[model samples]
Target chain A: MATYLLLSTLTDEGRKTLKARPERLQEVNKEIEAMGGRVVSQYAVLGLYDFVNVVEAPSNEVIARISVELGSRGTVQITTLPAMSVETFVNAIKGGR
Target chain B: MGFYVVLTKLNSDGVRAIHANPDLVSAVAADIQAMDGKVLEQWAVLGKYDFCALVEAPNDAAIHRMAVEQESRGRARFTVLPAMDMALYVRLMGQSTETTGPHPWQIRWPVQIARRALRNYWIDQHVRAACQPLTVLGRENLDGLARPAIFIANHSSHLDSLVLHSVLPAAHRRFLTFGSAADRFYIKGRKGMTKQGWWNSLAMATFPIRRGAGRATLAHAEWLIDKRWNVAIFPEGTRSTTGKMSTFKAGVAILALAKGVPVVPVFLEGLREIRPKGTRDVAPGPVTALIGAPIRFAPATSVSDATYAMYQAMEALRLRLRAQRRPDGPEEAT
Candidate 1:
């Protein structure tokens, strides 16, 4: 499986939703797992993003699909980035893959 | 019961201790349970925070006490936020917000008689039961105090008003009126009264006070003062969640100044642990009501000055009581 980084920010409506139902944050993680993605790490942060999530998924398409499904709720906007290990990047450069 | 989100961050020492013995992490839940709180869900997540716990506690004071005890060991820092279910939050928002009050009939002779009977038999018993071994200090301050005085106290719990009423000298209790939150207690109706509002006014001699309504809201209070009714108000306006005195609102000052009445400052101790705001259950505990000497301003005292003076009076009482409670010295580990 490939690793991906997900950064999320909540809209005003999303804040209301979260304020009323904080458990929804964990529920969304369950949703991700149901879609064939495993949440490796998640943190409620205090900076530019409301949450920082690291997920392992089968492929880019799967992660993209999960992001789209969650963003459609209008409460949260998600940005996803595919991540590669430093060892793999160094190997690819050496082998000229 | 109140739901709380307790976000705990372990310090370096805490991290080392937990790393040495991971089972120590369960101590968080145990600490909460020790405080009569239930931990519903907790996660040791990887992030800026070490752990997040959803707990149910009787009130803010209980949860705060638990947090203080836990953090005093210098292992964890906690941030607690009160939570409500989504449905309950929406329903509370949908409640009527219009200010409708100052029911005139509440002061009628018949209604006053009924209020006295209710206070004597029902309300008094409940307060006495919940506030066992209640102590009233400096009540002689009210012995010969004039009628139409304003009794101002530091607000810490929902029990403040009830405790104030229960311990008051009978002479001052009669013809006493208090201000209740308009949005919380009253609903706008065609006749300016709802069932709950009617009962509150008749049973407690309460008139609605619209928050931030300014001098206009004090019209009814002024009328009460003219009728020689004593007014009891928590100048803090709202109950303190942290057992600290919030800034005193100027309403009490305004009323006392306009009516040319003295303001008696009463300091309430130990009520926050009994049944603070947002708690349904009452735990019987000892409570002390320390009444300060009446604060009478010279003629034409400015509103700001009057408010500050009144606040200082209550603050003095609080400090004096705290010093008395711990005669040696204040505890270093808060």
Candidate 2:
């Protein structure tokens, strides 16, 4: 599984939707799980970005699909960044992988 | 000198810049200080925004300049919301700070003398007019009673005060002061005593008793007791709209127990029919004031026990009054 950081910002319509039905957020998380992704940690942030989610998916393709599926709903804009542990990165740098 | 809640959202470039030099966070705080604003609290929170900052500045224009200066850097968007202290906000919304209690002058001799004059020439006539054919029972109960006692009664009407005053022994009437509702009688948060309040203080010998004031209301009453004056209180706190006796508040028990004074139960009957709660028109009906024997508590008696004893005494008097009931009058058939 690959780790990824998901940054999300709500659109005007998205804010209205969330304000009306906040439970839709948890529902979206369930949908992500159904698409073979696991949300590890998430925060409802205060600034330009509405959410910061750390997730695990089978591969980059699955994460990309998850982002596209969520963004297509017009409620949120998603930015996914693949993450590697420092240990893994250091090992790869040392030609140990 | 004003507070502002500054919501900041870091863009991609800003995040990269901060990642390169985390000291930029403290540097921004320093910048705010240089601009004559103090950053009271800053938190990197997880939610709709990246950071929330509470800042204090001289005024709105000063904070506006501070926000513009920070936003001009293109690092983050600043949403500055003006904030006011909750207490100041409530005060601005017409919250008052009036002290409503028994006035010091009410207990003075001059006021007492004036109150006696008002009661004799004006109030007694009004009471007699309002409660026609008023029957007072057990005046002999107070014949040899001690001074500085608490008169506890069951309240059902506004005329209760008038009737109670009319029936109190003439010797004690000059020294008797009644505990009246502060909210109803006193102007809240006013700078000076109101004219009506002065009239009540001089004429009715009434003092302000705030609801749920607990021991605070007892302070003036205790002072009056120490001065060898009687304090009459409706333990029910307010007139009962149901024409039934409401449960007595325990402040009377605390006052009586603390001062070691006798609790004299005076039950006023049929005043509700004359002028009950929330009505102005008087029916000019027959009313009875039954002054029972003074109740003295043992030194070791609990407050609840003393309160219950006072209530029971009043209840017993009420039952006795009911037993002697006739269509014409409440006078016993002796």
Candidate 3:
């Protein structure tokens, strides 16, 4: 599985849903797992985005689906990015494969 | 000089600080200029990214320093992107010291060929020395191999492919193609593969392919095979997180069937413990490659059956190796 970084912000409707049903976060996690992507970690950050999610998925297509499925609920707008590992980065610059 | 862009976002305190000091934006621009790059444009946007700044720097390093220094202050976080002129980019990619391109017919200088030869020789020697206790169990079995073929092996550690490439016979090793993830390895192109550019590309013999379906990479592999080059693939798709094998994907089977080539089953052991998935540490250990005989299916054989047979061969090899392994061998080097 490849690692992905998801920067997400809750929309007005999503913020309301999350405010009312805090338990729904776990349900979303389950849904993400069901869609073949696992949330490695999540954080509420102070920045342009409200939430930061580290996810692992079988393929790029699978992760894109997870992002769309989660965003379609209108609770949160998710932005998924394929995260490059330190090893790959170093390898790219190191000139040795 | 290089063009750069930064997408910046301010925190609540940053917003409050900005209100307190309306000159904060100008201060940011000055900071960018101080870093040897001039801010060309600035915009406040309403979205995930708050502010977008365009700058032209003397070099990429200047931009990197600017971004790092800005983030270190904790007022804002920036996503940095470097932009290059299309003409300059094409010139840089095309203007090799010795000419080379996607096609091999391109002429290269003798110095370029010599440099690559030297690099390959060094790599061969380096791997041989680095893997001191490496035992390739099936060398004799692979000695008789004469034609181009595909080698399917387990993926656990990052070192698997390197070690495999290092241990292969010269004929098999020469011009061998590895199916690397296109997204990771081909991020930008030749430079994306490695900083050394053309040299690294030739040394690694990496052919970038898409992750899921075999459409893009499969065709690349087939092309390489047609040119009398062998290809290596990890049919388990991704590396085994737990070091246990996963179901073989049909991509390998399809490639073998389409090319009408034999599929060689290779089993790697001990490398995972040395350097497993999701890790950067490299522990020294004895790694072994148990090579099995090639599995060739008849023309009428189904892809699924061929895949299953390949999987079964690898499984049986693992079992046999386990049965023969000693309980107390060379302990894993810490």
Candidate 4:
């Protein structure tokens, strides 16, 4: 699975939803896992963004679907970034055919 | 959560995202909170930047973490600046007791003005007169452009603001406050900001405005306006990548309508070709400054109408300039 970093913020309705049901966040995380993505880490941040998520998925199409699915829920706007660990990056760049 | 400013520029992917779903922007903000930041305020602005968001983070590490997440993606670019309230800013300003003022940048008044004048003269000599041949039309229209007027122009290149400032009469030029992008022009940190602030104040006659219409952005411009200084703003917010005009933001309209100042629509041509973004070549060209007749909206006119008329006026000015070129002379029957 490829790693993806998701930077997100809750919408007005999303904020209301979170305030009304704090458990909803965990439930949504479970839903994301069900969609074939695993949430490796998550952080609630302060500044132009609200949430940062590190996730793993099988492919670009899977992540695109995930971003669109979650974003379409009208609760959170998501910016998904592809990411890799430094070790993996170095190994790739080393290039042994 | 501590306050922070997020400056963002949308790439082609970002543009497509928004085109497909405008609500995606709000969702992205929610993503920030999910990342551990609280987006306190956000604005979509015209200019080089797409959005400027003020957020609150628990600490530097949290924001840095967010930065890493955002920057790793090619969808958009972000410049994060830590923010302090005015009270905290003043308190920090007071940390410097050596000067009569809170900051050294504010202490010097006369010398800064002299340096600015000299710099403008240099800009005139090297850039305006010698290197670049800048033409002027309807100088008579500027006759009525009084002090405290708002000069609204379309941004096409780095030279646009300077060209507008240079063409202004000295009486107005000395008092003109240019709106400059804070992230691009100045550095962070107290000492760095102070030094850069002073330099910008002198060189550009600029007041740094974050890329969007945050609460502080227009307020700062209004403060400058109230001080009887002429203010120049690029309604498009950023320079045009392809040398075409972009939509004018309502900020200029609101500022003019709220302050009851006459808006002088200044159309600049050939600036983009002369100095495109990311290009070091300052190619010589005939830069035309078409100063439209000053527009003053009625007290009851809405901001949208005023802004629309301003844009139309600018477009018309450009068209009129284009039509004026003939073998006899470049004189247009205005």
Provide DockQ values for all models, in the order shown: 0.04, 0.02, 0.01, 0.03
Estimated TM-score for each candidate: 0.61, 0.53, 0.52, 0.51
Instruction: Give the higher-TM-score candidate: 2 or 4.
Output: 2
lDDT of 4 by residue, B126-209 (tens): 465422567888778888567799998878677778788777788887777777766555434336633555566666667666
Candidate 1: how large is its RMSD?
A: 11.8
lDDT of 3: 0.69
Q: Which candidate is the best by TM-score?
A: 1
- Residue B185 of model 3 has an lDDT of 45
Which structure is stronger by TM-score: 3 or 4?
A: 3
- The interface RMSD value for candidate 2 stands at 11.6
Model 1 stretches astray by more than 4 angstroms: A1-97, B1-92, B120-122, B188-195, B326-334
- What interface root-mean-square deviation (Å) does model 1 yield? 11.5
Tens-place lDDT digits, model 1, residues B14-63: 87777665657666688779888888766554345566566878767888
Tens-place lDDT per residue, model 2, B1-334, is 5667676789998877776666677688889999988887665644456665668776678888999999899999987766644322323234233545468788777877777666656577878788778889999999888788888888888778877877887777778888987766765644543445666777788888888867876788889899989998999887775555666778988998888999889998888777866578988888889999999988888899988898899889988988888766644321
Candidate 3 lDDT, B125-193, residue by residue in tens: 545544657888777767778668898888887677887787677778765667765544444433533
Worst ten in a row by lDDT for model 3 chain B: B99-108
What stretches of model 2 exceed 4 Å from their correct place? A1-97, B1-99, B120-122, B189-195, B327-334
DockQ, model 2, C-alpha based: 0.02
Q: Model 3: number of clashes?
A: 0
